[model samples]
Target: MLEWLAGGAEAFIGVFNEGGKVFIAFVTGILPTLIVLLTAVYAIIELVGEQRVHKVARYAAGNVFTRYTILPLLAVFFLTNPMAYTFGVFLEEKHKPAFYDSAVSFVHPITGLFPHANPGELFVWLGVAAGITKLVENGTAPFSLAKLALFYFVVGLVVILLKGIVTEWITKIIARREGVTL
Candidate 1:
């Protein structure tokens, strides 16, 4: 009974220590990389000029396939996750949801190559790659994580297209049935 009480205090202290370590690790390890990457991308966009960017956005807005695949993939991957939704401002109100869906779907697939894309869930991608590496070393599986990462990106884009198209059609159908225009 007393030992249980002692254990509770120890667990609480351990949690506090782990929280401090996580904070330090993130500040030192992740923050600088994130800053550099974000700065570099925005700089390139500036160099590319507003007209070129707007032209691409317009082209993507006009097509279901481009709207779902290239638009979200570029925005989500380059702009990072949150502002990727901000990029949806170019899209119509109806396409916004599908845009969000596609953006979110692309995050996980890109993680195979860019783990910083979903830094909080770092272990999810790292764990899978590590497991595959171990298996290949043991001859239990014959796979290259690098190749898998590339395939993951391709499949993710295809899935985003399929999901976006299906959701966009369903949304249009519902709107039409409700006597609304999209």
Candidate 2:
């Protein structure tokens, strides 16, 4: 598995690293996107089966699930792993010099993949996008990619709040139907 990743990364890089960072970038950025998609789908299933709020379920499953936003956040975490270990182990055999090159190189702005853009940069941008999305939905601000990324953490916070309330209600109902007491 490890050997294939390093050697095979050049092929898969296109899907995850639109910015082209590849290596750890693909793992952190791309893999997490998959997780988000999976999670959104899972959330939807939970809501539907539990008979929770349809709107939240649909939004999470449909819009958020499909949206490309999660990828950036994933990328951020993916890149944090040691560059050499990530790229060398997975994408290519350890080339000490190339490992250093990837670790230090900054990603290209237009490409987003890179020369080797820092994952942190993409993370911040995604965070901004998330924040902006929240602000827009809440009537707090206008839509803007940067703003959304800036507020992404807040957006997640808001989502969590909403999810908690809704999930709690669902749980209580289910408990009642099952003849269980709170």
Residue runs of model 2 more than 4 Å from their true location after superposition: 1-21, 24-146
Candidate 2, residues 1-182, lDDT tens digits: the string is 99889878876766666555545765886557655654664565576653343333233322322111222222222333233123323221212223233232312121122212243455644444457678878887855654443354445434433443344456567777998664
By TM-score, the best candidate is 1
The Cα local distance difference test for each model comes to 0.81, 0.41
Please report the TM-score between candidate 1 and the true structure.
Answer: 0.75
Provide TM-scores for the models. 0.75, 0.26
The sequence of per-residue lDDT tens digits that candidate 1 reaches over residues 1-182 is 99999999999999999989877876897678767766776787799976687678768878998999989877776667666676788899899878888888888888787655666565677668869989889998766899889999999999999989988888888998998877
Could you say which candidate leads in lDDT?
Answer: 1
Residue 117 of model 1, lDDT score: 64
lDDT of 2 at 41: 46
